[model samples]
Target: MMRKQTPWLALALLTLAPAALAQKTKVDAPPKKLYCWNENGQRVCSDALPPEAVNYAREEISAKSGLRTGEVNRTLTAEERAQAAAEAAQRALDKAAEDTRRRTDQAMLMSYRTEDDLRRVFNERTAIVDNNVQTARYNVASLREGLISLLQTAGDRELSERPVSAEMTQNIRLRHAELVRQRQLQASFESQRGELDIEIEDILQRYRTMKGSLPADSAPAATTP
Candidate 1:
């Protein structure tokens, strides 16, 4: 015959039942999470990700909250990495080019007081190049005249039914080559003159732009031509 349970003991057991059940429910419940990723052009969702899906970009959501809590960025493929590297290199090259242009502009502004000053310097350079061209032209003419004389002599020998000597043949070849070279030199000098004109114009344009942006008091006075 068991003794009757005490009223206080019975009350305690009744009070503990709900707390014990709540603890058990919390332990037994699955973690609340939702993972989403792109697979084969479709969006897939699961409580956990597969090993293959680890390489794909994914988002983690709280199942209870239905909001994104975390993200995992995918690893880049070889092609994507290469493209990124190429773009980076091109950006570096562009930046370097821009820096060089800026420095050149600054230097130009510092060197020239006015557009006329710039033009005067370039004009002097052009005159020097013109003189070089004239000298080359004179040399070319002289060489051409010498080659023509050699050819005439060779023709005369041929008319007399005589073989042109090897020395004379060699001389003619040398003279002809010299004439060609002199003509090329003259053309090069002329090209330099043209390039100078283009360079001066470009400099003037940039200088004018920089000066125009300056305060009127700070800007240099324009010179008379």
Candidate 2:
């Protein structure tokens, strides 16, 4: 009975050998077509890239499933490439500028507590310039008085038929020069004050705008291209 069972087992093994070989063949088969293209209204497929695909649209198909993966993108022209580069550069510049502005706004908001804070600082800075202007004006007034006194003395000597001494002549020239110098200094101070006023106004306006829009607890943001 054991010998009879051994022969039956051998027969069963031989019968299963062909099926195993078939399964192995299927598994080891070459890859199927991965791409297809339309040629004169007919679909053509190949595992290798088609030579005529230079101008033809390529449709990528899965090798295992025979389904479309996606359509391949075409090559860009020189003009298209240049335009895209220009647009990308412009976008980068715009992003950089925006990031700088955001950081500036954040810094401004953090530095000052309120709109009045900006105003207070502005007044404080402008006050220094105002002080300079006042000092210059005072100097101008003093010089003008001295100039008038010297001119009157010169007139007295001329009326008395006395030759105006060289020393007196030199004194009058020096006084006039001092008066001109003080007037120029006054004008410069006035100009500087005006510029300071404009700067203060600009800074105040920027502060007001940033404070209105930015949150009190806003954090610095990272920028990306």
Candidate 3:
């Protein structure tokens, strides 16, 4: 009877030991952390984030998550992209124009130290053009005389009751063509002279403005005709 009672007691202890160990494990386990997802402006929370959270901003702060707070991220819209490109293009244009202005101002200041110096340069440049104009005028005058001489020769032949020789006809035509070329040259020279005049006036006015000779509020200096 005593031996049978010992076997029963050992079996009862083995079953009680398993129950105690299970209870200890349950108490020692860590609590499950909560995760949340933001859908549009709404907050949806659970033990894990929903599949839609992949497209939305996530809120991990447990306290802040209850307030439904999260940051939204997205690509720019079409209109936004176009406006950004336009602004960048405008910036590039402005930078290029500014660079050109700076370079021009530097060159202008370096070329002339005084108003008299500017005038001297202007005169020198115009004098060269003036000489060209003079040469062109002389050439035109000479060609006109040659044309007149040819016309006179043709008149003489007709007055004497002789046929205008092919050679004389050709000579008159050649002289006329030469006269036309000279006149064209003269016209081009005059046009160039006018351009030089305008360019010189523009430079002078700019130089005066840079030197502070003209009042800042005053209108541009009137160029001499």
Largest TM-score belongs to which candidate? 1
Model 3 gets an lDDT of: 0.75
Query: Residue 10 of model 2: what lDDT?
Result: 80
Compose the digit string of candidate 3's lDDT tens values, residues 1-225: 465445877898998999999999988975444556556677776766566565555555345245543444534668988999999999999999989977986576666666775687667778888998999899889888988988888899899998989998998888789889888988998999999888778867777777685355643443343
Q: Write the per-residue lDDT of candidate 1 for residues 151-203, one digit (tens) a residue.
A: 99999999999999999999999999888899999999989888877887887
| TM-score of each model, in listed order | 0.55, 0.50, 0.49
Q: Which candidate, 1 or 2, has the higher TM-score?
A: 1
How many backbone collisions does model 2 have?
A: 0
- Give per-residue lDDT, candidate 3, residue 97: 90
lDDT of 2 by residue, 41-118 (tens): 998787788566655677888888878878976567789899999999999999999899779777777676767655
Ranking by lDDT: 1, 2, 3
* Candidate 2: segments with Cα more than 4 A from true spot: 1-104, 216-225
Stretches off by above 4 angstroms in model 3 are: 1-102, 213-225
lDDT of 2 at 102: 78
Evaluated at residue 224, the lDDT of candidate 2 is 28
Count of backbone collisions in candidate 3: 0
